[model samples]
Target chain A: MIQIENLQKEFTIHHLNKTLHAVRDISFTVEKGSFLGIVGKSGSGKSTILKSIYGTYIPKSGAIYYDSETLGKINLVTASPREILHLRKYEIGYVSQFLSVMPRTTALELVEQALLETGVSYEKAHEEAIDTLKHFDLDESLWNNYPNYFSGGEKLRLNIARAVVKKPRLLLLDEPTASLDNASKLKVRESIEKLKHQGTTLIGIFHDLEFMDGLCDEVFTMRKAVVNAYEA
Target chain B: MHVEQPILQIKNLSKQYGAGCSNCLQPNARLEKNFCPVCKTVFACKDVSIDLYRGEILGIVGESGSGKSTLMKSLYFDEEVTSGEGYLEDFHNGSLNIFTQSGQQKRYIRNALLGMVYQNPMLGLKMSFSSISNIAEKQIAAGSRHVGNMVNRSNELLNQVNIPLKRSKEPPKNFSGGMQQRVQIAKALSSNPPILLLDEVTTGLDLSVQASVLDLIKTIQRELQISMIVVSHDLAVIRMLADRTIVMLNGQIIEQGLTDQILEDPQHAYTQQLVYSLL
Candidate 1:
């Protein structure tokens, strides 16, 4: 569970001395296991909000509270870098819009590394990675291929599989299906649906309203630095 | 006087994306698959047909993406319908399909015939507009040009919803969540539309606040006799307000009946979980 209160985030262009307000006093709560979708047009700060939740972009004001089962409630905004790192490694997972290309690493190794870092055995990690790639409908031939060699959609699905390999408690996605075609999108939706049914809390920014409508339990719309939310 | 016909009639409505090909060309064949095997089309809504009588509350209960909101948005002209017909008794002689109407005609129908209360008050209320002016905007949209009449009607509606006259001049940004919702309700009722569509109106509110808003809604429904379609995931909200209920799962209505009968004897597995969870 997470509670974001009066969250404000801004980016400063030092050269121009101009401050870009990204999130302005937005407050909302995401219940555990529920999917919260953030929808907005381009430049509406939807991704900024996701980044803030992911703890990569600290808010200029207000607090983000995470109700962890083991650690109790912690303020993410004020959380130490180590604490944030630990949360990311164990509790929170993020899938960015672009895949961070690992030139020499295969897709299987990339996903297996996520599990290995979480203390899973190397053999177990490999097996799980295979299953995850299959769930994403990634072809068997693509598992040993480098992300750079994969198509845009293949890379995105690999990114998703890697992020969700550990089955983190909360998963943050920025345009999860942005690069996929209709069939691939459908495949990814099935994977997301399976994850949801398994009780993984999801927060994503989807410009595709119809996709978001079908996937999200609640949706927040960002406009002019303010946010308004509604049930899906 | 004779009983009036239903204000809204939806017939075999289906909203799907992509054109089906050979393998999935049969009607509703796409719905059985995760995605259409032929075209990869997703079914956002499927053959949803329902009617809203003149003065009755029709509740649509479902999990997210069950097509409940899509169904409402289609009626409000917010989402375009892919197929099937809908007719509003008071618009275009009751024979013209509301879904097929031109954008201008749809806008006219939305302004004069329908009122919507969103789950979040911020979506419905202009936070910077004075509470009175928020109500006035709807009246003005319905072609009320006289400021005096608009203000009078705004005040009357606000009073009916129990929003104080003193706060009517102030913007809604400073109001509490419940007050903001009440203001949204007042604004929605400003034009005295024949039909009101509510999407999870009490969700995310504190229990006491939810009760008060529900009470206000009940009073308004009884006093104004406006036809309604209320969509919610919460069964209790539906039980408290709706006369009839439709249970939806994955873009299809799994069950429909009187609220009491459906709750008492839920036949569908999903409806059973929903009803039992409420208890």
Candidate 2:
């Protein structure tokens, strides 16, 4: 459901005001139900690609097509902000790399917020949020509790619930397994497998080679700013 | 012969906190001396004795709140130990009692002699600072007089962890979790300190990144010959890295020995259970 053609993004450092070429002409395509893992060391442009796909960072040169819809293609890139702006949160659900959940929000509320943002009705969002939380082993009572009080594993589970509650076709996940423990890690792996089984296309960045090897069907390796072709 | 200098010696370390107020190493045991006049809670650390030698990684294997962090925090002077003293050389003096050192003195030694990396990398760095500047702050905070070369050193170390120079100027908050962790490791090693304490440093990284970072830490330790204390519940990581293993349970050390002794030939019942469960 996703296709990228020679994407490049350059970031200018604020302190030095120097342009650092973070990503240099990287491109790949993911079928409707494929699992893609982008592997790279720090600052290897793994997160930038996901952000670009999610519309957080507007790449300087590149065209992204999701199921025939242009995400970052010049047509939409130059399209008035109003045209592409509404498609982001609705079309692409992103699980941020760091602390995805806010301190004040409950697990249920976070999931509900995601669904509502995508135009789900209030009553429908609430019902879907309950199902999402229950599937992840988050109890109703604890769902009402703020995420700050939840354990690291609980927070990660909530983040996954919030991102996947919408059941978007394209999911951009940024290190979804970082905070989980051994047992919870197993649970998360199973959950991702289920999501893949349901035909939700995924593009995730993970450092855990073992976990990534098991979860990702295709691995994208980037070294020194340039990306090699996707490998299975 | 692996001759080791006794870097830190823990003698009868015990700490009590919260409700229950008893030194109950045995789950059902009831003791009177364990009670405290404060919050009237049971002690968390119980008569813990261990010796950390230089140039070796001491892996503490335990569940959460198992007194591993407690011992580390007290040894690093981040927390106060209720009883027992940790003896260590003062670099110049014959030896210094860790507890006897003043707060400022302990802070100085803590900053210079020890480096701590927490599980969450976000908390470790200033969110606003770039990867280079985050690492630079560690050496600067350690009271190092060399300021001009800090950036250069930062670049080199960040490069060491595979963080590119291009992202060196970008705020670490913008980096991925695995990338942020690499930056944290780079910062921890900036000073090239002697003893390092890592509490779940690889918790937030992907498995592949975890292996790479673990290898990086081992390489750095071998190059610098620094004593390391790695505390984590992941036995696979500890088994792959540590020279010695300490099995902790409910605020007590159930077993302490070489990795082979703990993993292959366990002596304690608790250690046996832990090793067996891992299989």
Candidate 3:
């Protein structure tokens, strides 16, 4: 339900007086309900492509065509800021590699905020957030604890749980399991697999080939800002 | 998706502290840190526009002298706009520009449709007035005449913000910093305004007290569904509370987006530094 065509992005470093090409040229499409995994080294533009689709980065020249369930078919690159914001709220969900924990916010509150911001009732959001955290194997005792004090794996799990709790139509994960132990990784995988089974489109960047092998329908390898996709 | 009009819309709002000269009158006048170097005009807020949706908390974040507080003050009518338009869905069906309203009309709107909690408790609450009287003062200004009804409502509001009944009769001057802020919140909510403007409500409180006040604000938002505009220099408070965030620099909005997006991947260089500094 998403199409990327000739996506090119660059960063102009003013002090250095040079433009760094983050994504030189990349194009791919992900069908509805299918999982796409992007594998690449540092600065290979894997995250850049994801950020473009999420409307965080404006491509130098390209179109990110997304078939939003709410806003019809729209090019994310050209969509109005309000429309992009609306889509981000209701249709697209992104889980970044690092958890940007808000100080004074509890783990449960962080997850519930995802639902709360989208107009979900407080009681229901609270219940669903707790259930999602439990599904991600975060201990019950940590529910009220601040995520800033949590272990890396716990924080990652909490981050994933917060994003997936709302069940957006499109879910973008950036190194979701990077800090997790094997058991925690399995739990996160199971939760993601469940989301995919429920028809949420998944696009994830993973360093673990084995973890991605069992999940993604196709793998796109990026090298030096170029992408090559093949069936898993 | 069906489009929803913003509960409050501000367009091209500008507030300046001095008379403009030829050098600063130009549309593209370059200012030295939000002040005109030649004319000595301080542009506290320049061409600021904002949209606050129903039941959402919109955050304005910037460092001191960035004019975030000025923007909040202008919206709450504590400061007059130099030029701009403000529309509230509850005011004249969103057809009237509130900035141009008559003094009486402006007072009516402020009393009925808007609530503001200042950063300093002294600015928002009377020092010698009992907490309940402070809240009742707002309800009375909003046209509540029955003393008994006003008292009950004030008690309920005080309790809602976690003020104990025993302390309700005490003046806010006797309260702790956090408690004074809570009382200020109760006073602001007394009018049952559709929109609430809060300026650094938890800025000076202890860490533990800050958390509780923040928690109280979140709970109040969920329960009351009041659209709020929160102004603070603290990005952490904005991240915890704001649904959408606007980043201000030198009296102008440099960047704005979903709070998650702003914190995750800020686009502007200034915003990048602000977000990175948080790490």
Top model number, DockQ: 3
Query: How does each model score on TM-score?
Result: 0.53, 0.51, 0.92
Q: Across residues B1-279, which tens digit of lDDT does each residue of candidate 3 receive? A: 778899999999999999989989898887788899998999999899999888889999988999989888888788999999999999978999999999898888888898999889999999898999999998988899999999999999988999899989899999999999999899999999999999999998999999899888888898789999999888889988887899999999999887867876676888877877894
| Per-prediction tally of clashes | 0, 14, 0
lDDT of each: 0.82, 0.74, 0.88
Can you tell me which runs of candidate 3 are displaced by over 4 Å?
A: A15-18, A101-105, A116-127, A228-232, B28-31, B263-269
For candidate 3, give the lDDT of residue A29: 90
The positional error of residue B270 in candidate 2, measured at the CA in angstroms, is 1.8
iRMSD for every model: 29.9, 27.8, 3.3
Off by over 4 Å in 2: A1-232, B1-4, B18-40, B90-94
The order by descending lDDT is 3, 1, 2
lDDT of 1 by residue, B1-279 (tens): 133466788998988778767766575464453257557877778888887787778899999878888888888887888898998889865889988878888888888899988887877888998999899988888889999999889999889988889889999999988898889888888888999999888888998888788877866786677888999998888877877789988777888866755675465667767866785
Residue-by-residue lDDT tens digits, candidate 2, B1-279: 123347777788977675443444456566444444444666678889887776768899987778887887787776788888677654434266777778777777776777877788765788787778788887877786676789888888988888889889999889887788778778878877778888888776787778677877776775577888999888887887776789998777887766644675455566656767784
What TM-score does chain B get in every candidate?
A: 0.93, 0.88, 0.98
What docking class should model 1 receive?
incorrect
